[model samples]
Target chain A: MRATLALMQSRLDDSPHLLRLGRLFSETVLIEVDGAEYYLTFRDGHLAAIAEGPSRKTPWRFALRTDADALAQFWQPRPRPGFHDLFGLVKIGRGRIDGDILTLVKNLRFFKEFMALPRTAPQPEETA
Target chain B: MTFEPVTGRYLTVTVQGRRQRIYVEMAGTGTPVLCLHTAGADTRQWRHILNDAELTATHRFFAFDMPWHGKSLPPEGFQTEEYLLTTDAYIETVLAVSHALGLDRPILAGCSMGGRIALQLAALHADRFAGFIAIEASDFQPAWYDIDWFHRPDAHGGEMGAALVSANISPHAPDAERWNTLWMFMQSGPGVFRGDLSFYTRDDSLIGRLARIDTTRTPVHLLVGAYDLTCTPEDARRTAAAIPGATCTVMDELGHFPMSEHPAGFRPFFADALARMKVADHV
Candidate 1:
């Protein structure tokens, strides 16, 4: 899980378009996977830090909760129907969305594109 | 020094008793195929079909931007009432456009909201059309979230529409084509997408009417994309299963905006459907 987050951060850093979209976008998005938590903090659209959580300290604007299997399926090179997208995950009962929906809607494109980075920009086999 | 095979025009039609100017595009010259786009989008979605050498050679493609979408501006005094796409208004406009264009029993091809309408047309007015291709559609599709966000001033309707619908396109789709599909949604007029969704998502579905669909009068074909969560393949299959003799297909590597998102991948399925329609017409 930590390895994937590392790759996600690396991929996020290299995305010029995402950086452009994230301009002045500062927020903490919480991603909960199988009871484990990952707080992705973005400063001006760049991923500043990804903090792991078993404790409650970081405040998040929105939280996307899913199992590890669902997250893996979502990040696949060619994900199946009802598993290829964030909303797809939520719609199919594989994932959950909580907190401010309007915030999620506002940064929707930015969120969708950046989250998809790990898939579009593939990493070495070792990472997989 | 070249131009696209497609040409654009405008015609005035009365929708729900109000005079409305509609923008339409067309290409080719065989059997007429009336194309209908998804919600918040316009006729630009059919550009690929209109330009396809093979399709244009065998079939005439005509697509119109429903009033308030694309170059088809909303009727005068539109601001007076909240915009909503009721079943009656939608059918009225489609019939008016078909009549105005002199299309003789054209084949109806619609996607998403357009798809639901295709089902309605088959049930209520089957003899008027040759066949129905309802792509990425189902009888009942409840929106995941509130529909109000699509039109409210505080929220950015265009971006939200683009973002939400983008989920329905396949990840393998060409970047340029994908962006073009999103751009159309982004260009939609305020409340226009919401208006369409009013009928598509919030309104009563075609459940009670599906059993009444007589495919022999007008064959019904439901095609869905693998990635369209809004109206998944399961939904299309279920809808098809209910309608007697209606056929359903799940298109791999395609999504809701198949026509506009990736023409190369979309054309084969569409061409195959057209062939089936032609066969049905002869029988």
Candidate 2:
């Protein structure tokens, strides 16, 4: 998940569409990978907010505190084999989505596009 | 033998309210071939064949995604129409691109779903292409239609075990290389497994439709990987026998993915197909 997240960050830098968005606000995201949970954040085309501190509780921990059963429903993230279906990874009943649902729905396409970038290539050096 | 090498290009296409990412690798410069990938693999699997020293000299090849599998979109929901849309969308896209490029009916070559779509496209829209080369594509049994294959112990266990065991089998490969391949699918998690398992379980009687195809017009060739776990050589042979005037060849020392696993074996067989197509054109 970290590797893919890193690749997503790299692609966002080169994204023409995203460059137009300018800097984004910090939003906390909790992504579950394999069997582990992670707290991640995205803003300004960079992953600026990952959980720090020991006993790191995921952002989803907050979501679970609010609604435990709802969090359970989100855990069954079934990623589609098709490229279009990948966006389902972050959608409702897919990933452990929390916070502003409105923002997520509105900007889902941008986020999905970021995830779709070819991850097979090596992480290119940052260039001005 | 020398031509401009094809580079992989990534594009976004929106399907059913979802924006999907797809990669297309177009090589050579003649009749276009839409190379289809198998289950559990992306268009990357066609790298060797698309860049083949012989085939590149004669044909233009294009390979891309089939929705949620590769760089394409994941499922909105698993429905037959969605799966069918994946094929139809690709064919339409290829056709439109070909028309814009001013190209004619090119041959279709596929493995597994790639092969399944070759047969499907030929059956529904035969006029779209010149011929088909289906490798290990005709393994579906009638019983498979009734079975809940996703739940099958052998299928799931085998798929996971195959990756781990195969990686271990390769001594020369570095640990990172093995993990790279294994992690690619593993990271996708159980959702991908269930989705693909459901996808593979889908099979219908294209046998009758296949027989109705005019072999003289659209020459069909069947290639089988000798040790194919999913689609056996015998099944391929049977499929060929059923299709009027279709030819079958069993590639040695290979399994379900002969194109990737044994390109040396594929070269001559593919070369022979090109030759036969040329001979037919002249005659």
Candidate 3:
């Protein structure tokens, strides 16, 4: 999990086109897997830091929460039907997106692309 | 560069008691093939097929924009009622156009909603066309999300619609075609995409429709993209099962909008389908 997140942080910061897409976005997005949460803070499109969750102090605009099983399938080399997409998760009832939906919708493409970074990048050896 | 092979024209036809000057495009000369686009999209979805040099050499292709989409405008009294596509109306328009053109059993190549209707066409009017080619389609597609957001005031309708469709595209699709597909989807008229989905997601009894489809009369070939969650490969296979002798091909590394998102990759699959259709005719 740690290695994968690090890979995501590096890819999100280095990819020029992705950076351009998220250039206007500056917000903290919570990614909750199983019960553990991680705060991904972005400053002007750059993934500044990812905090291991202590939800009490961290403020986030929106959170994409899902189970470890779903995430595990999603990060596979080729995910199955219901686990392949972010919205696919929602439809299949394996995931829940809470908080400000407007912010999420406004940056819909960026968020979707960011979440799919693992699929695009070299898969980390660590299992989530 | 000015004179491309493809040509465009208007066909004034009456269907469902309303006259519409439908925009239609054509390219090449040979056995005629009438193509149909996906929901919320115009004929431009078939641009690649229309312009395919190899296909053009062997087959003539025609594509049209549905009324209220692209260059085709709605009827005079359109403002009085909502634009909702029904099965009967859909069949009427296709038949009207085929009759207007004086085509002799032209093959029907349709995708998505157009594809769904192809099955209906095969059942109701099999003799009119040589065969049916359905792409990324199924007997019925379950509504996966709340379609209300597609046309609501707060959301940018076009972007919202495109966003939903975009995720279904294969990750390996080329950047150019992928963005172009999304761009066209982003130009959808307000409520138009939603209206199209109403018909696409209509829960009318398809078991009877499928049972009536005689593959012997109108040969059926279905192609579904692997990444298509809207109408998964499983759906296509199930549909083929319902219609005996129908063929379903699962296109790997492609998604819902196979033609628009990965035209180059889709060509071989389409060609294979065409070949199969030819063999069926000989049989």
Candidate 4:
């Protein structure tokens, strides 16, 4: 799971936008179980994380882990009273609150944005 | 068991000197839910959804035509957001009708543009609602600075206004649904396009006011569709996160108009929202 988390991190860390944004939090906790893996990354604006749950297939069942309180703080519309200092406490491969469904939302209020500005159409392949 | 038949009504009211007739269909017994239509759509977008058995069993529902569309009269200066009907203006219009019909402070259930007004009303007159259900309410634009990809002048300029109607269903929806969505946009006339620029470009901080929203005791539940293109789930999450105690629920596989797109899935979420607000003093 740590390896998966690291792999995901490398990808996001490589993005220019995220890099430009700087690290919101110093460290993140990664959890994987039941074919699901979630990375709870803490950052400045709020307690932010990325979850790649059971949506992925095979060998990886759905499992999630975060700073215990981090899971409780996630679904809150606004930041909980105190979630900043707890960033470093989150660890990899520790699946606390595994069966808790509300824990997903209880930990973070995940907002998904679907709209994208139309992208340019791919040009025709150069014919040899 | 005593069953009462649902009743519907229509009346013409004058707003800013324009004779806009409001058509209303309401039934049930409890606090009312004032339904607002989205951009480029009329009241009928809510027509079928309102008739659902579960909704009727819970509370009274009132849906009306926005000015210049459906049965309402076309106002003179609606193109500009400044000139278009405002939260206060609509409240006044509804007040007159409600006063005539005897209604007040019903929970607001709005989508898209209607959602904006609901948020506005909740912020301004917090005492009015027991709770609010805003479906895909526009909380402000997302990554507005990242528009390097958009290039269609018409899409930007409202030339393809037909494509911009509110509470959107889907491109491949049945013909009748498509026509309804298209007609809603068309009914806005050229003004709808002009009005969108005003809507989409409004200051973001105005929306930030929700951060300070004291909804009296009324809690707000954000019912956002996971796949909503217009409002987007990220916007919903961000907006919900901004509010103090707002509960955010994202319906799966649903689009901008969850009520129309997936009522069966939306009912339980709606019920849960109402239940959350039903707690003491949270009204």
Task: Give a tens-digit lDDT track for model 3, residues B1-283.
Answer: 5777889999999998989889999998887888988888888888888889898998888898888787888889877777777888888998888888888888898999889887888888988888899998788886866666677787687887887787688765677788988887788877778888888887555657887877776789999998887888998999899998899999977888888888888889998877666643553
TM-score of each: 0.94, 0.54, 0.86, 0.57
Chain A only, candidate 1, TM-score: 0.89
Candidate 1, residues B1-283: lDDT per residue as tens digits? 8999899999999877899999999999899999999999999998889999989998999999998899998999988878888888898889899999999889999999999998888888887799999998898888777888888877779889899888898876777898999999998888888889889987665888999998877788889988888888889999999999999888888999998987888888898888878755775
DockQ metric, candidate 3: 0.22
Q: Which number leads on DockQ?
A: 1
How does residue A59 of candidate 1 score in lDDT?
89
Candidate 1 chain B: worst 10 consecutive residues by lDDT?
A: B274-283
Ten residues in a row with the worst lDDT in model 4 chain B? Answer: B143-152
By TM-score, rank the candidates, best first.
Answer: 1, 3, 4, 2
Identify the superior model by DockQ, candidate 3 or candidate 4. Answer: 3
How far residue B267's Cα lies from its native spot in candidate 1, in Å, is 1.3
Tell me, by lDDT, which candidate is best.
Answer: 1
Off by over 4 Å in 4: A1-128, B1-7, B12-19, B76-100, B142-159, B164-179, B203-205, B280-283
True contacts kept of 1: 0.57
Chain B TM-score, all predictions listed:
0.98, 0.74, 0.96, 0.77
Q: For residue B47, what is the lDDT in candidate 2?
A: 66
As for lDDT, the candidate ahead, 1 or 4, is: 1
lDDT of 1 at A48: 90
Q: After superposition, how far is residue B176 of candidate 4 from its true place, in Å?
A: 5.7
| Tens-place lDDT digits, model 2, residues B63-182 | 876555666655455543323334455455545534543456777788865786677666666677778888777835432222232223333422342342231111222334334434
